[model samples]
Target: MSQLAQDRGISVDHGTAEDLPLTTNEIDLAALLGVIGYVNDLEMVFSELARVVSPDGHAIVPFCGQMVLFAELYDTAAGQEAYPDTLDWKETYPLEMAKKATWRDVEAVVSELQSVGFTEITTVKTLTQPIETAIETVESPSKGHDDGSWIVVHARRE
Candidate 1:
């Protein structure tokens, strides 16, 4: 992916957190946008973010939650029988996991990031409405449903 971006004239830096090739405090902004959920250890990544980012440097992370309606659907459906564990479901139904962003879980992520030394938490709530209202307001003629909502939280490493 970095190579593809480089082909488009974008410079890329590649390294693991254990041996970050970038100089300390060199990154001004870190966008974990729509990514942290896919990681095995979110807290570890946040620690890396704190280590690499300068004071007041921004880290924008967009993650999904567990309380999303589709997740609820999975929880209430055969998924319970199919996977019996969240990890199994995550692997088997990746799209569902991707779309299952929720407030409670995302806030937990925020708290974890804060504990890892990132601060100045700011959250943006996007695409939220009561399920019933969403079902009624959706204009698509083919189908109508309320699948919950998503959020984008922006924070900084202090």
Candidate 2:
């Protein structure tokens, strides 16, 4: 990952979520994609985000909710799995990493962000249907979290 960033002239810093290796107010944007489910200490992570991001900056967090897991289980039981093709889509960390993940709901995420001094919270929902239909919604993500297995939450640091 660092190599790819370096190739594009982008500097990358490595650190755990609870103890980010960054100075206070150091960055204008913090993207926590696919991170909420894996972190054991969300409060510390959010605190670090609050400390490092500049005031009025933004944080974007994308996550797959627990409902997705249920759907996958259902598909598997029906012998119609939907994730086989995606398993090798990218080289990822070991499967052991999944053991640490705990799916969180959209409201919980929003509340966490707000507790950390973030505001203007909004959500973009996707994956409300099968892959084909879901792809179409990507260009115009629905508002709110009533119908999506995947969601992206956008918030601004206050």
Candidate 3:
């Protein structure tokens, strides 16, 4: 086995999605930990993951939600509109990596992943507490903002 083979848990440094070391119908799970935003191709990567995953396998992807808020904030705070121009693709990336971070919309991300061949898609949103709610619920001095919302999508291969 190659280093890529050993990187299943750490990181699979394959040349490309098409060249992943895993054989077809072998992988039980394909997981993307906030990585989709950096990939150049969404459909192809999803297709490759689907190909590698077994019929009974599942893919878990966690990404940012509604990054527009962060982008707009960064643009305004930094006085630049095109600071992070790379995050414009909602499917592949987000709008403006210029912010301290970016987020994604749960519905849209899940829909895009499912349309590419994933089944039984499910999404969970994290860090969505409002500023007022955070203070009341958690009793923390730090106020929560909607800016850090995240989405996690899980789907199975067909």
Candidate 4:
């Protein structure tokens, strides 16, 4: 993706979302897609985000709750019979193991952002979409779902 962006004459930087490769206070905005749900160190991630973004810049994070990953698959009758133990799912899907993995709903995300100096937090939207059109589908080799909703949390640095 970085290569494609560069090829199109757009600047690109190869880096992890938790640890941006850019210099301090250089970015005006940091738009995170759907990856924060899987990041283990949200505290650290928010710290890094604070360090890099201008004091007044913003970070737009879209929160996908644990249900986003476990829904449909784990919410079914057969799923309960076969994967009844969420404990077992920890080994299978480690994201489920972390305390903040699911963001505990959007409020958690807002709290983290506030702790890290972000303010004006707002849940822009929380809407469901057909899973077939989303990232993980029933045909997916990994965990798939029939439908899911995402909570988009938008906040500003101050």
RMSD of 3: 8.6
Q: Model 2 over residues 1-158: C-alpha lDDT tens digits?
A: 89999999998888988899999999999999888888988888999999999999999998877657434433453354233554433443334444455777778888989999999999987777765445444545789877777789999999
Error of 2 at 45 (Å): 0.7
Ranking by TM-score: 2, 4, 1, 3
For candidate 3, what is the lDDT?
Answer: 0.61
lDDT per residue for candidate 1 within 42-92, as digits (tens), equals 677778888888888888775545577534544554444454343323234
TM-score of each: 0.64, 0.78, 0.59, 0.65
Candidate 4's TM-score reads 0.65
Q: Compose the digit string of candidate 3's lDDT tens values, residues 65-150.
A: 56544334444545554434543423322235534443445665666667767888866655455433432343322222234445
Which residue pairs of candidate 3 clash?
64-103, 64-104, 65-103, 65-104, 65-105, 66-104, 66-105, 87-94
Ranking by lDDT: 2, 4, 1, 3
lDDT against the true structure, each candidate:
0.61, 0.77, 0.61, 0.63
lDDT of 1 at 17: 43
Candidate 4 — which pairs collide? none
lDDT of 4 by residue, 1-158 (tens): 77888899998777886778999999889887766766878888888888888988988786555555444443442334444443323333322333334333565677888999999876644324444334342332222212335566677899
Output the number of the TM-score-best candidate. 2
Among all windows of 10 consecutive residues in model 3, the one with the lowest summed lDDT is 135-144
- Which segments of candidate 1 are over 4 A away from where they belong? 15-21, 73-104, 130-148
